[model samples]
Target: MPAKKTKPTWTDVKKNLASFDNPGLIALLHDLYTASKDNQAFLHTRFGLGDDVLKPYKATLTRWLWPNWLKNQNTSVTTAKKAIADYKKAVGQPDGLAELMVFYCEQAAAFSSDVGLDDESYYDALVRMFEQALKTIAALPEQQRPALWTRLDQVRRLGHQVGYGISTSMDELLIEYGVDARRSR
Candidate 1:
């Protein structure tokens, strides 16, 4: 009887490639990209070769922050959550996720005033954005984390003036993040 053949796993392939030289690695990548459309697309997006690298992400934030017709609190919260997840999947990896979260905070801030929205519902939605951002800061590099926190502090100050900062949870989150909620300025 013939012996069973095991399929080649990614671990096996990675081990084999451990001895690859620069040119060999490049050649292997080129071959892999050529062999699979998925590989090509991944390389394009992953290496910033694709145009509109941040287009979809920008659009996602815009849609929630500034809806085409009217601003909806529920939609904003849902969209912001989805945008955070999308950012994690597409851009956030080892170092740059904070930028995306900060961008979301900015959008949420602008979103507060743009539609003349200053109610608790909308503010709560905005707070949700801040919460997600705060949660993500731990994953960011030390150099990047403070900048995001600074932006978030600014948002908290502004949101407080506008009524979104009324959420006790928001204040708690600020303290939890080691932010001086009293000196948001």
Candidate 2:
């Protein structure tokens, strides 16, 4: 008789936190930021990019961020400050601004939560910080503006799949972009 194959153990599944470096963490932060921003843009555009059209997305953003504000415990002070600034910069534009603000607030809240900020005060601070970031992004040059906006659309679509608790492999995203998955990565 053939020998039975053994299943992988939990000990094999666990990753050593110490082996993980700052760059990986920073990259994750960047990815999360991009995903949130993209999702925000997608929501705004899908609903018509008008002030009134942003209500649902805004509400959703608040819901997503509020929990993060209550859970993260290792976020850096400087990074949190920068995120707020970006949020303010992105908020005052005629197109999709409010949605971007929502994204920024969510990011800030996540960072704060990660850094051990679990109080209502942190949530309030994140709101104010995100507002500031929105104001700043609204001031960019028109030529440079479309890139971020466009990328946000892509991000939003992918985010929707993630938000729905659907798992999308990187290959799927690559295929959507018309890249040959095996070669692309």
Instruction: Write down the lDDT of every candidate, Cα atoms only.
Output: 0.66, 0.44
Candidate 2 displacement at residue 179 in angstroms? 32
Q: Highest lDDT: which candidate?
A: 1
The residue-by-residue lDDT of candidate 2 on 5-93, one tens digit each, is 68876665455534658997677646655787654544454435666644544544444443343455343434434433343344534
Q: Could you report the Cα RMSD, in angstroms, for every candidate shown?
A: 6.9, 20.9
| Tens digit of per-residue lDDT, candidate 1, span 1-185 | 99897998999989999999999999998998899654554465577776755555666777776666533334466765675566566445644455556677677666665655656766666676677678777666665667677787777666655663444666788888776634433
C-alpha lDDT of candidate 2 relative to the true structure: 0.44
* TM-score, predicted candidate 2 vs. hidden true structure: 0.25
| Cα-based lDDT at residue 4, candidate 1 | 94
Please identify model 1 stretches exceeding 4 Å from their true place: 1-44, 50-52, 68-75, 118-121, 164-168, 180-185
TM-score of 1: 0.59
